[model samples]
Target: MKLLIVGGTQFLGRAIVTAAVAAGHEVTLFNRGQTGTGLFPDLEKLKGDRSTGDYAALQGRVFDAVIDVCAYYPRAVRELLAAVETKHFTLISTISVYASNEQLGQDESAELHTLTDPNTEEITGETYGGLKVLCEQAAIEMLPGNVLIVRSGLIMGANDHTQRFPYWTQRIARGGRVIVPPALDDAIQMIDARDEAEWVIAKV
Candidate 1:
């Protein structure tokens, strides 16, 4: 199978690419070529920015599955489908889409955050989840039954550039007592990028 990955250079995106390639699938990456440029030296890299409507590189290209790992806005999702032709569309969504996180064992059917202003494209911490929700909707609207969305939680693993989770692990290695959250039980939920990548590849 031929897989086209959007933003296949950082964190979870990089993991998906590696997993897909290891699974004997032909992988093609589409990104702005800004970060993680040194990685995946042997694969095909299509330089473009979906955020700014720069999908010219993806024109006429078709794939078995299009794994979008970095769509922040619904507008970008719309632009993406218009640019690439693919049989299946997979979106790497976040758990942040939930309207409330206090509930335990919530599934994808849980209420999702809503975007206050639909026309605004500005992405900030407050709008991130809402924008992602919109992104999911956009894909579903375009592909109907051909879209799959993975509501991923905090992704942490090797090649994670954020380093927020790694900071705690590194501190623990230094032989120092670390402060943990007051709600210890089920206070945290995270998925490793590599593990998620493997699952995504299998599904694709």
Candidate 2:
């Protein structure tokens, strides 16, 4: 299958590219070419910037499937889908879209956070989750029943630029008692970046 990936140079995005290549799929990448630029030297990498809404690199491109990993606003998603053609569209959304975390075992039926200012392009802690909800809606609007939304939880694994998981892992490896979070009883949910990437390619 031919696949196109948006932002295929970082974290989960890099994992997706790796998984797709291993699975024998032809892949093309569309990103700003500013990060992990040295990686994936053998694949086709298009140059574009979503921050500025520049999708010229993808104009006339078509793929069997497309996985968008960097869509943070509804406008970006709408413009991106309009720029390319694909049989299936996969959006790498987040669990943050859920309005309430108090309820246990909530599924996709759970209510999503409402965006007070859908027109706002500013992405902050307060508006991030709501914006993602809107982005998901935009994808559905653009592709209808052919869209797949993966509301993934905190993604953690190799190639993580945040250095978050590595910090804790290295600290614990130092062999000394450490300060632990007070909420030990709280249930933690997360997915390995590689695992999620593999699952996405399999679906494609």
Candidate 3:
């Protein structure tokens, strides 16, 4: 299978690319050529800015599957769909789209956040979940049954830029007065980047 990956040079995206290549699938990366420019010297890379909605590098391109790991807003999703032709689209979404935190064992059918102003593009802590929800909705609307929305929780592994989980691990290793957050009973859903990548490849 041929794959076009958006934001394919960082963290989870890089992991997905690695898995795809290891599985003997043809892969192409489309990004602004900023991060990990020299990481994948052999794979095809396209230069363009998604924020500006510029996909000139992807003109007249088609793929078996398009994996969008960087899409965050509805307009960007639409712009991507308009730029490419593909049989399948996989959107990397977040579990934060759930509307209720009080519910335990929440499944895919759980309520998701929705934007009051559909035109809003600013992504803040207040709007991130709703923006992801909008992006998922847009992908579903565009691809219908061909869209795969993977709502992941905490993703941790090598090449993690956020350092969210690594900070705690390093702090614990330092053997100092590491301040641990309260709420030991709170549910934590963590998935390794490699594991997530494998799952996505299988689904795709």
lDDT of 3 by residue, 134-182 (tens): 9999999999999999999889998999999899889899896877769
* Residue 113, candidate 1: alpha-carbon lDDT: 94
Tell me the tens digit of each residue's lDDT in model 1 across 8-66.
88889989999999999999999999998999999999999776799999999999889
| Every model's TM-score | 0.94, 0.96, 0.96
After superposition, candidate 2 runs with Cα above 4 Å error: 175-177
Worst 10 residues of 2 by lDDT: 183-192
List ranges where model 3 is wrong by over 4 Å. Answer: 185-187
- Tens digits of per-residue lDDT, candidate 2, 1-204, equal 989999989899999999999999999999999999999899999999888889998999999999999999999999999999998999999988999868889899999998777899898988988999999999999999999999998889988988868888998899889888998797777788999999998887
What overall lDDT goes with each candidate model? 0.90, 0.92, 0.92
**Residue pairs that clash (backbone atoms under 3 angstroms), model 1:** none
Full ranking by TM-score: 3, 2, 1
**Alpha-carbon shift of residue 146 in model 2 (angstroms):** 0.6
The runs of at least 3 residues in candidate 1 whose Cα sits more than 4 Å from the true structure, single-residue gaps closed, are 184-186
